[model samples]
Target chain A: MLRQLISANMNSLLRHFLILTAMLVSSGLFAQSGGEDFMRSMGKMYVVVAVIVAIFIGIVLFLIFLDKRLTKLENQIKENGKAR
Target chain B: MVKHWWKILGVALLIFAFTAGLLTPIRPGINDIQPTAVVAGQTVSLTLTGYNTDFNQEQAPKVILWKDGDHIINALGVSVLNSRQVQATFQLPTAFPLDEINELKVSTSDPANGFITALPRLRISGMEKGGEAAASAWTGTIENTDSKGGFTFPYLPNIYESVRNTFYHVALWFAMFTLFTLGVIASIRYLLTRNVMFEQRAVSYTSVGILFGILGLITGAIWAQYTWNKAWSWDIKQTMTAIVLLIYGAYFVLRISFEDSDQKARISAVYNIFAFASIIPLLYVIPRITESLHPGGQGNPAFSRGDLDNNVRMIFYPAIIGWILLGLWMAQLNFRMMKIKERLLENEY
Candidate 1:
């Protein structure tokens, strides 16, 4: 009897999985054939933005680092002048 | 006491008005309604939903539904299915010959009964007259028929309705802008007259602005995680907002890092000026130019989109104004408290 109940549960789970898979496939097909061009345009937009941001961030960080170094050097010079 | 008579009256009036507005439940609702879903040979279902009873509990509300200002469905068709069920669907006429905007109006309550009087409304679009053909064509264009089917922008993508966070996230920045604007004015006054009181005002506003900014970033990250599949995608807007925040955070650091009162005041004032200047572009300009997942991106129109109808604008504009005023009120109180502390210290000295 336990074996029969376990098989019944497994069969129901399999049926549910099949239904979900069918729905996904149908939706996926609709999206692929009709949605490709639009998705590509959008993907291109995101990639372009990501690249620009990466470059800008790099430059900003470089400037910040350069400023820190220059500030340190300026402080050292002021200290030297005081000593003299 | 005679000199302060106006002040006393003003306080009493303010208290009375606030209490009344709070007590008056003007929560909008739909009464009797009819909707025609099938106008112009279309097979679309129309449903109307809203709260039923008035806030005053005066009487069961009644509504009359009209098509093109013609009474098609009378108040009798407005059946209460379930006392709490707020939605009603109706079948549309096979052919609707209207050219202009179709309006839905919930009529005013019975004025004799002393209930709140107002007509809540919903609008049916003109394009619906052309039927499903027009709607399908419209959705097809918006969904983008090119590579990778459907709309490309994540914000518009069906998966990312989560982008409504744009209002809350962006609203926080607007609040920050407001507080910082106040800070700038206070800073200028401090510089002009060497008033430490003005300096304290500036500091208090900036502190609140920073708090709002941080909360904005956190909310933004939470929203980003749902749409971007990660908490921090480093989009241009995100990066810029973070940078703007850090710049102001630096102002606080500069103030605490120095012990000399004059030096702290001068340096912090200068830094605040720079922070405010950078914020305008960081929050407004660069995000538009760079690839942005945020709304108002290269392709996404920020302000004028079909999604945000006049109905949304009604609530949204008031919400922005209310939040900004609330921020200002809090900042003003902070300034007053700081002033009291300063006065106490002076007394001791």
Candidate 2:
């Protein structure tokens, strides 16, 4: 039973890794393909890009917090409601 | 009192400011002219480009030329090239008291629709004249100062369309200052009461404030490019601001370097206070006293009342409020998350 559960966890982790990698690769591809010229065409309005970045950063930070919360909850359940 | 009412309000204000700030139209003003210098008794075709002004050649809008507030050389009639550009043929008074500098202004007849109030003084540099002064068209005439116009940003000579950057650049600075103040307050509270929650809050505020400061710098550089003709003008104010940002960066470094929770809180809080204190002189005070390209510089266009007109101020003030509220909301979320992490770590130990 312990071996089977470990295999299942590893599979899920691998799947998550693949998905995140795909997302990063696709975004990098999009940026590499004419994103620079596209942004420059708009009167060098790079300020808009900066604003978008700040928003995405806030969202990413929040997601990180949520991820931590989920990990903590999962650990608690595994420990049968005990911290250590 | 962790109420979310203000957070919602802040978001709403930001939405309005963003939409209204972009949507608001600027009034008509001269953007350019050809042949900056002029000799007496010459027919010059002056081409003028306006921001959002409509010009009708049939209306015969007059281009008033003032020579150092004493002489007048009124152009004959405005020939409208399009809504944005127009031309006028000016017959220089053969002999007016010659001066080294002269100014040319243009406006339409509609009093309700005011024209560029001030500051875009198209200088007409005078050349050495050989002949005598002829009976000129620019005789004694009443210069119109009061023109009723729709709301518009002040048309500056160099800062043409980039005036829109005001919402992003100026408001971000305001927001950064507000967030930093809150951070300093939270740090003091932590030092006084030894509350871990306050320390977390202080960290969040400082982080968000630093984010704003970074945004301010980026947007300011963008504006400086078009107006000052350089990305980094080496202005004292901008250099000081960069230094202040680095100092705040050190505050975060101090926070993470200390592994002990209590020591991190105590030391980082002190550093945060010092960082905030330094911003006053570096960002605001020294910039005003020194010769910089910023608004407060000596003999700068900022001394004029044309920086933020009533229309811009309407949207700008709200933008400040929105950005600050958003920063506060982010800081609050960050604190909550860090607090949870702190609890989990404590449980582990």
Candidate 3:
């Protein structure tokens, strides 16, 4: 049941992530003009975007590491229970 | 639901902070002025570039060159080049009222965009030796223009809109500090009671705190890259923070090296206490004492009235609280997982 709930959460998280990426890409294309770099063009607003992305990725990776550790512990418990 | 109210509040505060931080408009400011230096006795045309300014408004901007509180020279003529640019002609007096003052402040005030001053002082050359009579050459009063009444972020020259990063980058450090404080408390408790539960809590909190410190460094580096033109300049604050992280990194290495669980917990608990003690001097005291590029160096307070006005404080305080609560929540999860693993090992025995 816990596994089911986690998968459901992951599915929604994936959907939201894809939507955010699509919006950013579309906005970047529209905001581009002349010879200036796309991110640098809009008053360097993309610097803020870059900072937010770095933070989000850091938190997500930390979560993934925690999830992997939990998975290993869960496997150890399952093996112990079957042996008994 | 009552037990989880703080969690809900954390998420809500973060959503509000993120939205408000991004959506607010920045107040108008003069970004640059061309022909930084002017001859004392000549008519010179100077071009002013502005950020978030509307120069083409119906009410034209009033430009002034100010030497001191009592002396100011109004622009002889002003022409709008575009919304963000203006050309103003100023007739300089043969001598400044104050002979020692070589730099003049340039300011522009318009009703639509409010008042903004150029960051760089204008240099004046070829001025004759002056007496009290030179004060007569200065005419006109600096106009008192009301700021456009609304909530807006203050404009900083190099920082510009990225001043919004104050919410994320600075708040991350605040959150990290809170976590490390909690970790040290747990470490002290473990030493007193010899309880493994407190040890687990300490480990969880320190791990999450380190994660946050890393995030803070990455975000700060990104901000510095554009504003300071370098991602890593070995700034004093940067060097101090790196040392703090390395000190805590050794805590984890020490934890893994000990084969006995009890010895591991007791020894790491003592090390954690020392690590926490080092933070105050490394992050706070040394940075202020040293000549540093980061704000708050050389005995100046980091969050002065100028650096964090009421407008920024609104979102900034909430961001700190939200990040702290979220970090605590992560630590709680890690602690629970550790407890479960311990239980599974006991059952195997």
Candidate 4:
């Protein structure tokens, strides 16, 4: 029963991830034509967006660093349990 | 949940800062003026361009050439070319009231949009010396127009709406500095107590501080690219901040180089103390003493009354607090994770 539930959750998560990726890709294509000029004409609102993106990336990178540390700890614990 | 009140507050303050900072309309101001210089004793038709101004409102706009408190010349005729453009004809006196050649400020006052003045654009020449009698030739009285009442950010030249980045980009540096201070405190505590917990805290805080410092640099570079027309200008503040981050970066390298935990903590604690000591001079002292393109350099002070007005201060202070709280929350989580890993390793041994 737990396995079925886990598989269902994973399927939905994958579906959502695919949808988000498609949307982003489509938006990227849409923004390709004169988007730079449009953003410039809007009094450089793009700079604010760029700054926000940089901060977001920085936070994500820190989270990834923490995750790696956790993974290392988990692997170390598994190794010790096996040895014991 | 009750213990997490600060986390909630941090998120709330950030929401408030982003909404208020980005959505607020900037005050109306003059962008440009045509025929910058004018001759004395002549009727000159001047074109005034405005930013975020509406001239065709129910109340007509007034134009004036202001020399000083006593010597003011009102436009003979005012005509609206468009919402953003106006034509005003000024009849200059044969001689300026103050001097032979006068640099007069052009002012546009509209009831809806408020008043904005161009900086010494209208130069009045052909005035003879000792024209103090011409002060009596002024005819129009300066009338005070009530500006539309609301909260608005001050309009600054060049920076324009990109000034909104202050809440994000600058707040990151403030947050980074707070984390570094906390890390230094933890380092001192570790040295005194020789406790592993405090060492964990110092490492976590310093790591998060470095992350924030990197983010601050990236955001600042993006802001400079748009405003200053360059991404990396080798600005003094930028160089000093990069050096500070590198100093802290070496702290992490120093941590991993040691196999024994006690030796590692002791050496790193001493290094952290010295690193924190260097920040004061590099960022605060040297930047102020040297000529820097950044604000707060040389004789100018950052966060001065003129640099951050009351409206910006309302959001800016909240943003700094929010970012600092968020940084603390991240560091705390990292510290807890380190403690858990250490516990697991101890149990295994």
Predictions' DockQ, in order: 0.01, 0.11, 0.28, 0.30
Q: In angstroms, give how far residue B274 of model 2 lies from its true place.
A: 2.0
lDDT per residue for candidate 4 within B217-311, as digits (tens), equals 77787677667777679998899998998898788767766768789999999999999999999888888778876766685424434778688
Query: What TM-score would every model get versus the actual structure?
Result: 0.46, 0.76, 0.87, 0.88
| Residue runs of model 2 more than 4 Å from their true location after superposition | A1-84, B67-73, B97-137, B140-148, B298-305
**TM-score attained by model 3:** 0.87
Worst 10 residues of 3 chain B by lDDT: B296-305
Best-performing candidate as measured by DockQ: 4
Ranking by lDDT: 3, 4, 2, 1
For model 4, the chain A TM-score is 0.54
1 versus 3: better lDDT goes to: 3
Quick one: how many clashes does candidate 2 have? 6
Q: TM-score of the second chain in each model?
A: 0.55, 0.83, 0.94, 0.95
Instruction: Give the worst 10-residue stretch by lDDT in candidate 4 chain A.
Output: A22-31
Q: For residues B154-271, write the lDDT of model 2, one tens digit per residue.
A: 5556554456667767788888889999999999999999998888988898888876776566566655654575658888877988899889978865765666779989999999
Who is ahead in lDDT, 2 or 3? 3
Highest lDDT against the true fold, candidate: 3
Selected candidate, larger DockQ, 1 vs 4: 4
Tens digit of lDDT per residue, candidate 2, span A1-84?
Answer: 456446545644553464344334433343466664443333334434444344444346445644755676566656755533
How much of the real interface does each model capture, measured as fnat? 0.00, 0.05, 0.56, 0.67
Error of 1 at B107 (Å): 28
